[model samples]
Target chain A: MSTVRVVCQQLAPRLGETEHNRNLGARAINDAAMLGAQVVVLPELMQSGYVFKDRQEAFELSEALDGPTLSLWKSLAAELDIIIVGGFCERLDDGQVANSAALVEPEGRLTVYRKAHLWNREKLIFTPGTAPPPVVQTAVGRIAMVICYDLELPEWVRLPALAGAELLCAPVNWPDAPRPASERPGEIVRVQANAAVNRMFIAACDRHGEERGIDWVGGSVIVDADGYPQAGGNAHRHEQRLVADLPLAQARDKYISAHNHVHQDRRPGLYLPSP
Target chain B: MSTVRVVCQQLAPRLGETEHNRNLGARAINDAAMLGAQVVVLPELMQSGYVFKDRQEAFELSEALDGPTLSLWKSLAAELDIIIVGGFCERLDDGQVANSAALVEPEGRLTVYRKAHLWNREKLIFTPGTAPPPVVQTAVGRIAMVICYDLELPEWVRLPALAGAELLCAPVNWPDAPRPASERPGEIVRVQANAAVNRMFIAACDRHGEERGIDWVGGSVIVDADGYPQAGGNAHRHEQRLVADLPLAQARDKYISAHNHVHQDRRPGLYLPSP
Candidate 1:
């Protein structure tokens, strides 16, 4: 068993700055690769900005899998022998657009995952993802990709977790939520709980700055199977790129103790009956 | 929709002192009823006290549903028009014993829900519960019951939330775990996340104090459907009964925004097919 070094890049992207945002993502990827990260994750809409003006502006910013930004990332992933999971505005056939994330592995395999649960204003511009999130087996671990608001839905993560997803990569632009005083933000609690329940490692990269009256939470976290942060995994109020070694083998141990097994103890028949 | 004032009683029980523990529970119930609480919850194994010595000892501490403690509670429920949910060691026929929570409604209906996932050392003495957690319709709201470790399983809570449970009454005896510095304990995170994910309110009553060299975490919390604590719902260390007004109507608001519905947004085919 080997430890997969995971990096979560908390960077703030400019609105509608496609080329410049791509450069920022590339620099973060390069730095993470230099630091020996096997998997590097970027914030949501890393290639374009969130807070879209209109559908036409969104189309102008969107890119396909083989387009310039993804093509550059694919080449970089192949060259560095690392996997890149980053969010982008996606342009598909017949004027369809989505908030999506592209997963490029070292073996030159690329899979695009769209955001399933659209947030407040994104429903006006991007299409809500229809396909299930993809779980890809790689040298580092079994990885699953989810765009921004997808993390909020339990089924979105629970489904992949049951399918043996070891690592959940989330690219998020979390707007400020009302948090209780002297407590960790609700987003942090949400990730840790989901990670602990499924016995999987979750790496969520959140944007760190304000955009058009929308203030980002700026909290990026990577929680282990026990729902606790590994060293250098919990960061807030800063543009940080932190890496932690995730023990993939431990995630396979859903048995917290001899009697309690996280996954096996689930009464799925009570949740949803089996076919 | 009338408000159901829910009370969580956090207090320590004496080991091997069934009469004393029942008296303590009665006092807490008196306090809660005086405070206008319609539903009062108590900690897990409130009668038997956790950390048993042997099987014979556990049996000595166990009682049937018609036992003295439950009869007292039934009379009190009828007298006060308040519902009581509390944990006790259940002694069944044929020398079988189980860890169970009894829900005594104001109408004299008693439902016993066994502990599904027994913690360490408990598997040695008690029979693990087989039936799914039940959701019961009450005058004030739809209620559900689960023991301590059951809260850790997402399916345990998610099922009832989907079944339209508004208030989840949990009788927990949370032992202290290794917590990171300046961070809320992992137990708090688990409850809040599950509550928010299912769009339901959860009120957990945990025990406070040490018993036979084992220390329990005494933080009792009642969180709203959105996962933030209601006013006066967060109580730590000390023998206290806290009450919060639960908006039962909001738990039915699975609709987070105009487009996103927590339960409706599920892609079950991707998880497991429905029968």
Candidate 2:
């Protein structure tokens, strides 16, 4: 069984500054490579930040999937020989924009996934994505890509898992307000519930530092299939990179030995749809 | 604004001991009434403990809604002149046993709710309840009663709220296992989430003490519509009653204000159901 080294890169980019944001992303990738990581994940909309003043501003930040963003990431993947998952603003040819995440392979091959569950303000800016999520086959393992709010919707994650995705990658930019520090455990509880219920390794990378006058909760975490945090970032501090050696074989064994048994027990026909 | 004194009682019953359980319940009600509690909520299955070895035992212990259990509660309610929520095992005249909860008025009138969601192990003993939950109009306000697992199922709680329930009463007999003492905050998170999302005052009473070799986590709590715990029972102790003045008027006002303005913002049609 090959040991897989994964890194959760918690980077905070200045909102609307494409050049500096891209540079920071590149630096994080380099840092992961230095730590001998086979896979790396970044936060949601790492380039544009979470708050968009208007739809027009969000559209201005959007780039084609094969545009300069991919080109830069492709070069980085080839240079490091590692898999990189990162978020970006995607502009379709028809002028519709989507908050999207992309999985870039070491050889420059890429798989893109648009955000399925849009947040409140995001509904005003980006069009809702209708395409089913993409689960790409990587040298390390099967990987699925998703963006911020997509994680909140179980169907969005469940679909990818059913499609044979062993690892789910989420790039989130959660705003730091409405909930106080005392309620931080509640946030972790939600994340843990998602991991335990799904029985999958969730590598969720959240944005760190202040952006657009709002503080971003920087709890970028790598939760095991059992819903335990392996290694990651914290809510208050800006962590550059968190690297951990993951046992893909153990994860495979866990799924086959226990999760498969649980799946057989699910009475899907009787389940009430989300209300 | 009229003040309402609500008492959230955590009733821990010894499994299979009906007589002792009945005495304990009667004592709690009398104590709460003496303390000036206008409303009191007892834990789920107060007459019979959570775990029943087999259907025979459950049926043997079960009584009709108007049988000895309700009869005892009726006398207590009339004598105390206080509203009481108590849980029981109902033996339907048709020979089926249903986990049930009853809301007893001060004048001895009764409104009962059968458990909607039967959890693990329970499915083997109790039949799934077919009757829709009923919200009775009370002198204090409109109140709805539900058994343990019913609260975990959103529809069980949500339907009653839609039917004009200002307050939700949950009687739970949660087992103390799986979670370590360090994870106490994780337990409270669910209570807060349920209260906040429902936008209705929730009086959740949980059982305490060890019964039939299973330890019950005794953190019976009363949460405001906004998910704040106004009063709570401690995790360490057992067989305790907590009394607090629940401001029903403030909760009603908040719910109405949010409904009139934010009702249009709820895009239920777009939101996916959570698993």
Candidate 3:
């Protein structure tokens, strides 16, 4: 009965409102900690907001690792004795910027992962990361971080899962699109599939509200190792808080059947490195 | 608009009832062709049924490429001017048996793919395949084939999708599992996610009815490039037929957004060959 209380705060951040967004993030973290959450996740680009007009604007909003937002998060994490995971626009060398997420532990340790697979206009706005998603061994459980479209690539997800990540926390801003009525959004469906295939838990925090005429799906979800939604598997078009207690132990046992172990059953020899 | 009508006939096959199962398959294929289907898919092990009593029993039911089942399918495919994809127990040298599927095109070209990933009890009963799933360039469109459990591996599915398979026709036997009410089965969700990530069309046919006290999910589904079900996305407990006219041209255009093409967007270099 080893469980971890996870929280995803689906918030709306105004574009370029760094100070306000930092406050919003602090409030969400405090609320989650009060509810006994051991790990709290926030949406992608919470510091500067998504839907940037151009690379120049994103660079203007980007923050360094020592910047106020991450500094505040690091302090809060240590003060609350909880782990915090959230996205921010990262300031890079030569006036470059990257979409990055930071995982701050209560012990003042930090691990950062830049978005590897850039979504739509993000190609023009940020430099894609060359390193794989980072899987950190935290006190609560082994956790990993990836951003938005990175979840779409199962190959990318497999890296961390094989590396012994029990829970994958993603910060996403899923844009709204027309879908069949009464069907789950494909974004959330993909997340469930990713979790199930690797026998890992996933908590994806998505943002709400429209930014520059782009409304989001607001489809934050937490799926168990079997890929079933533990909480918030719907598209709620408003600020929401999704909380779930995941039996992290279930992820340690990858066997779906007596003969099959998810990771061990894979035949990578047949799969080419790059096709 | 170049469209190809695909049909999935979910039928039950009595174990070791080769003659009866042949008639059942012939009837389903005829029915699909009558419905103007260019391609028809059937469930895994349709020729010999799943839930074998032992390895000896499965070997006894195994057939070669020139066996009556595939021979009949090849004749029917050429005669009816359509493609038929279905599963059977393949007899290998030295009394070995492999769970395999055959894709018979209108030109009488037969492509066989052995199930690389075996399920519970199957590993004891059958020899696992070493070859990857086969993608064939058919007259209707470029199609591929893989059997059940193999579908659970996204890396295996990616092999065909990356090989320019516009549509992947799978023959699956999804054993019934307890799922939350009003939720789509994880098997179907994985199918949708695979299609969406690859921007490829997929039609997976599952069987119905009880076999040796083992019931099935009967979750047959046909998903378009966008990962939305065009037909049969539910778990019906009886024999059923799912049909959809797929404009496979959409699969060729991998771009989901202005900047992201599903295949081109893949950062394969970062993904390890054997992770």
Candidate achieving the largest TM-score: 3
TM-score of each: 0.91, 0.81, 0.98
Q: For candidate 3, lDDT tens digit of each residue in A1-275?
A: 97999999999998988999999999999999999999999999999999899999999999999999999999999999999999999999998999999999999998999999999889998999999888899999999999999999999999999998999999999999999987899999999999999999999999997999999999999999999999999999999999999999789999989889999999887788343
Model 2, residue B83: displacement in angstroms?
3.8
In every candidate, what fraction of the native interface contacts is reproduced? 0.61, 0.01, 0.85
lDDT of 2 by residue, A1-275 (tens): 56688888888877788888899999999989998999999888876666888788888888887777778999999998989999998887676788888899988788888886676677778887766677788899888887765554444555676566767888888766455444443344445545554566778888777756777677777766655667752465575566777665444442322223323333344333234
Q: How well is each residue in B140-207 modelled by candidate 2, as lDDT tens digits?
A: 88888877655544434556765667778888887664543444433344555445545667888888
lDDT for model 3, please: 0.94
* CAPRI quality band, candidate 3: medium
Global fold similarity of model 3 (TM-score): 0.98
Docking class of 1: medium
Chain A accuracy as TM-score for every candidate: 0.95, 0.91, 0.99
lDDT of 3 at A142: 96
Tens digits of per-residue lDDT for model 1 on B162-195?
A: 7889999999998876667655667878898888
lDDT of 1 at A24: 88
Q: 1 or 3: which has the higher TM-score?
A: 3
Clashing pairs in 1: none
* Model 1 bad stretches (over 4 Å): A53-56, A231-238, A273-275, B53-56, B231-238, B273-275
